[model samples]
Target: MTLAVCGAVSACADTSNTPASQRGFFGGIGAAVSGSDERRAAGLEQSATDAERKKQQLEARLGAANADAARTQVQVQAAEQRLAAVRSDLQRQKERLAALRAGSPSGSSAEEAARLQKELDALERERRAAQDASTAVTTATLRNLEERTRAIGVALDRLGAV
Candidate 1:
């Protein structure tokens, strides 16, 4: 009776720690076992770590892009202010020239007026060019920032899914 009990107890004992090849067909004494579960857990951990690292990198990129956009905006504002100042100066010069013309007409008055008009025209052209250049630069900067923002957003979304 003792021998039969021991045999039955040993047969019913758990063998999850034993290699599948070594365990008999009756290895179902306990829950199923394999290295796959542990490997899968480790793989999941690695994937999660990679996702976190990617998310952090994307966030850094987004921060840098935002800073650049802010700096570019400041530069654009300064340029616009400079253009406004130039336009104001041009207007003042025109008013002063008109006052001088109204006060007198002399032998050289026609020539002097022509020269002043040409100078005013040149100044206007210069102001227009500067304004256009500033606008172009601002546009390019905004476009670059927008593209970077979109790319970063996509990367963040992928990280979230992961």
Candidate 2:
């Protein structure tokens, strides 16, 4: 009887140091046979979770960054178009000035010639002012777009998803 009792006790005894609660959870391994294995498993699981969460966050931020980049691109294109228009207007003014110079009356009164010359100078000055204003606006618009693009790129870098 004593031999039978000892056999049963030895058979029921737990050999490994792993805790019972950390084992047989839904009949699957929770902890591990070795303590280091348990710790490594925990670290790996945590790292995987952290990586997944970061990926989701980066995806959300990327959408916003892409939208900002698109908006900036549109602004840049519009600024370029306005600049082109201003340049075209300047070209037209040059053509008009050339035509005026070529068709001046040969023998107008001295006073009349002086008045025509003054009119031409005033028109040229006005056209130049308009051209300058357009250029300034276009430059400002392009700068704004460039700043926005830089902000988007910074965001992308910060996310580290790129």
Candidate 3:
């Protein structure tokens, strides 16, 4: 009878049939064996680090783009000013040529008129050249500004997503 009772008690106490979590007092050994918590922590840490690195790279790119845009804007303004000054000078040269033509009917006056005409022609050519250069500079500045704007937008979107 005692042998039968001992066999029943041993069978009831056998923890091999139970899960590891249920076998331990606090399931500490089971957590160590799975290591899920530690892995999750490591994954989270790596994600944070990657996010920070990406943000820094974006910031640097944005700064550079902004600086480039500013410089291009300044160049465009300078080109416009130069074009305006050339146009003003051309107008003054035309008025001077007209005045010379109206002065008198003498050989010396005629020679002066011809000289003024040549100067007027040169001024017109300079004005046209300045206008063309201004147009090219403005176009380039606009293109650069648009590209930088697009890059900034993309960076902002990425930052939001992160």
TM-scores, in order shown?
Answer: 0.59, 0.42, 0.53
Is 1 or 2 the stronger prediction by lDDT?
Answer: 1
Model 1: per-residue Cα lDDT over 13-96, one tens digit each: 456355556666545332233343356568779999999999999999999999999988898897777667666766766665
CA lDDT, every prediction? Answer: 0.61, 0.51, 0.58
Q: Select the stronger candidate by TM-score from 1 and 3.
A: 1
| Candidate achieving the largest lDDT | 1
Displacement of residue 103 (Cα, Å) in model 2 is: 3.2
Clashing pairs in 2: none
lDDT of 3 by residue, 1-162 (tens): 866654554444444335555655434343444454466568779999999999999999999999999988888787777566556655654664565456553565566556556655754665566567664655554344334434433433333333
TM-score of 3: 0.53
Q: What is candidate 2's CA lDDT for residue 31?
A: 28
Q: Pick the candidate with the highest TM-score.
A: 1
RMSD of each: 18.6, 17.3, 18.5
Worst 10 residues of 3 by lDDT: 153-162
